[model samples]
Target: MSVLIETTAGNITLDLFVESQPLPCFNFLKLCKLNYYFFTPFHTIDKDFSVHCGNPNYPNPPNIISSSIIEDTQFQDQSLSPYLLAPKSTIKPTLGTFSFVKSIHENQQVFDSRFIITLSDSFDDSLENQVIPFGQIIEGFTVLETINNTPIESIELKRPLRDIRITYIHILHDPFPDPNNFHPYPLEPSEFQLSTMRFPELSKTTKDINSDNNNEYNALTLELVGDLPHYSIKPSPETLFVAKLNPITTSESLEIVFGRFGNVKNVNIILEPKTKKSLCYGFVEYNEQHEAESAYRKLSKGCVIDGRKLHIDFSQSVR
Candidate 1:
């Protein structure tokens, strides 16, 4: 069966694998029939990665019936246990795939109500056992792109600066039979450890090169490799790929230099996984692509900071 979701961005249609995910499919269908997804915001949007919604907590239009209430009243006979056993086959969370998020506590896995639709490719192995893919987008990819490209106000939480809400959901066809006696299966604890890394501290002063002796500066260039792992759907003109950074360079120092061009959305210095120290390279995302392009061009022409000549270019990677 197919489902049509009407959102503030646009309509997105999904093709469900009812046979593969009967429990989740029927559960989602039942909720849609009751208008359970109305006014729900896409709270987590990872540009070029995914758009996640279905949080019962942060619904639009202020107050509405909570999922918990619905579970207690209308779904009294239905099993609302969050952890259901999924298929053994590993599903790659590629572009346009749909999956449900799982939360772990005290070595038990429970499903969250959130639904995630991939906007681009992802190969995170940690997601293999945690997310259960049950569907794929059949239409409205451009709308997905629009949502993925939305300017992010917060990087850590992945919240969009503007709101994107699910106005309604229309089930075109539902073929799965409800499993009223469904029970959640127990799961082993996941091995993946969540990262607790934070950006490095910024330098207090950025030393600028004297205009009269600019030629004395030797540019330190790091060879560009394949695009960065995370990026937006389209190449952001307002984002810069910075390289050859001093290992000690702080996100604060980059913000000061780039903020001169325009409002800096985020300054990220890629860090070593184990040490959590600077990788001597980073990215700066701006509110406007033009601002990022401007910073890249101007800085590439040989800008010196803290006695180090920097190499800058337009970032081609998407997060």
Candidate 2:
């Protein structure tokens, strides 16, 4: 059996070892035919190691083609007879082979949709027992290399700097029969929901400004690092540029106005050289990045003080 995985990075074709690894191959092929992998990001990528995907929660619920694959249902339980397979010696894992990420519980190996594509030849030797290599990349090694070269997040978070997603899976040949009473979706899902142009933020919700904004700040931090890892560290004590301020707006008033959002580190109003009079602009620094972001989102739209409209944004000038 063979399948073609079309990703944002490129296309990769894999030949499945159906005879040697029937269970893994069967599960993989069935999921592909049903479009179970649609619009799922390659959440973890390491250039030196292998790229991992098949995050159960990564796929948008609407994009899941088959309702048969329910939440929290691992591949082992979906089969005809509930069974789990260990790594097979029949297919010695080599570079560009597909492998299931083994999860051991009670000293028994369990299979799931999550899988990895080998990048380095030494990968198999390192994870021989932990992963099951069920298929080999027959074509598109260039695409595989492209993904391997892509930049990733920190070692703690292996997310790719740019989202490399599986847009579609094309099953070329399948020797295995479908499971009993199984009805796969007839057509591929529309990309309207999961547009490749922009990586959609999942499950964002509005919350009280008084609530802890750590989660909100983390989400913004991830978005900012998408194109480049320019910032050496998370922007702490984030500064905001306040323009169109009332000529007489004092630093104390600015602090009072913005302090409601979060802790006010300091406020500096630009002043004339000799007069020390306000220049109608200033910078407000927040002790936390989320505070500045919250204040910006709330006050940037329309903030009026001392009978003048205030314009707010993150200060471009490095402090």
Candidate 3:
């Protein structure tokens, strides 16, 4: 069953499995119908294997769902036991997983919503039924990937972490977060945590980088790793990557309007981190080198944004 899970960035379509694990599936579906999963999160995220959501608390889980630290996937002579509430293994978690920690006694049964999803791909054996793949992501994986790449400094752990935030969720017949309000987080989490979309160029080496923005104009560069927001990996062009224009003229709008005239490959808006403002400029990446020149000659004049005539041109060299 595919259901629409809307996020602030966009809507992620999901395919729910009703048969694999009935209890968790029912719980998940119930939460969906009741909107109990609204404004929740899949906090434990792995870019390679999976992304996990489903903490009990609004922002955090009250207690880990699996109380008893039982065996997960390593038990020998194990028959495919079909019905259990929590996971009974120690294996590292994977994507699309909804495994609950289980107990050795089988009496200490507990289950909450702590779950994960697989962002890491290209592994055959890693995701071998270890995690219960209850539902699949449809639309918002890109946005979700962006979130997974966000770098967060763990003041507590004294390390960095992937920025995972859930702004809203609609679960059925489950307990809603707000007793007063009818719906969950209507605004998307990304709207609140904008910085998390792209991986920070400056990895969290020290606390001051996160605290102070105006440290120095260090060129932000990083090793390509973990949840990349989008496939933005082309080398910076020799020409500058901005198009000066008035406010209200968006990069997307320009791409749509001008790209039709010729073989324009792509459009990009360069944004300033602190200000969150586009630098009043854009990039028109054409499919062929010649197409860019021709389009620049033809369409660079009288571009209108917010009724303001704009100047379109090649940007500074990106090195």
Candidate 4:
């Protein structure tokens, strides 16, 4: 099957093997459809190497599509004819990518949220038919390699240049490739380019004071406290911008506040059971983070929202 691997930089086509990794394929596909992949950057990219992504505590619950490991006629047929297959190495080099990661258990599969790409060009005979080869990147190897090689730290591995990120991810189709193995089209940009028309300008005095006051708009501290993995890019609608709100606020209030900042595509306010009150913290989705951050700030600090003073912050609102 075909899907797109999106990062903050750009998008690349990933030709996945639904026939082989049925569950992982489905999960990846579902996540893509939910536009979950568009903004999430592979926090750990090993240049011309492997690209690993998916951190559940991401913008959202992380649209992870899972299934039981079952073999059907589709995936049962396996052949080693494919030129690009995951090869085993003393250490799997970040090349000729695979949708997996180094986990705690030998056979444990917590990596359903994490996938890797290979960088090695030649496949060693030792790796022949040993590991599952799901797919290869159809395009943007340079961009992918750049991400892998970038100097950063991995939230999971806690290593630099390990955790790369994309605002979000999406999958598009070209319908011109072979059905058995399609080299899918690259997913298009979800971020909208605002047209610059005759923009409004004010006096320098006003501008300077407003700029200073804008900073005074009140800042919320998000020290990346949670153990949840951080993305190369923050969450947004088009990106991985997950909205957080207080318990007392209703969905309508969220939409009103967030929708006003930008075009809010979806807003979901999670609530606690039994009492059925707002969880005080839920996800708000915007087409971009600029909009989400704007909303978060506007609605924070007694902004006269929902007939009450709202306490908004990035640290999970952990009330």
lDDT of 2 by residue, 1-319 (tens): 2665666565566888877787677778887876667656676676756888775345342222222232224432445442234334555566888888777545666666788887777663656888877899865676777778776657777766566767556565677666554555533323442232233343243332224764454445333424213323333348987766778789999999999999999999876544666656668998889999999999988899999888676663333
RMSD of 2: 21.2
Task: Show model 3 residue runs off by greater than 4 Å.
Answer: 56-60, 63-110, 122-130, 154-164, 170-319
Using TM-score as the measure, the top candidate is 2
Tens-place lDDT digits, model 1, residues 59-122: 2222222332223344455553542455554568888888876665357654445678888886
Candidate 4 runs further than 4 Å off: 56-94, 102-111, 122-131, 153-163, 173-319
Model 4 worst lDDT run, 10 consecutive residues:
190-199
lDDT-sorted candidate list, best first: 2, 1, 3, 4
Task: Give lDDT: candidate 2, residue 96.
Answer: 88
- Candidate 1 lDDT for residue 107: 70
Q: lDDT of all predictions, in order shown?
A: 0.61, 0.65, 0.45, 0.43
Tens digits of per-residue lDDT for model 4, 25-114: 554554454443432444444444354555533323332233111112233233323422423333333355565533433455333445
Query: Candidate 3, residues 1-319: lDDT per residue as tens digits?
Result: 2344444344354655555454456546544544445445445444454445554343323443231111222221233234354443433433433444332234644455555566654435644443445565533456666656745455343212433334333221122122222233222222222333334444454335653642221223112222222223333332323333555667778777666666657676655444566545556676666666665666665556566665555532222
Best by lDDT: 2
Off by over 4 Å in 2: 59-87, 105-107, 124-126, 185-319
Could you tell me which residue pairs clash in candidate 2?
none
For candidate 1, the per-residue lDDT at 118 reads 83
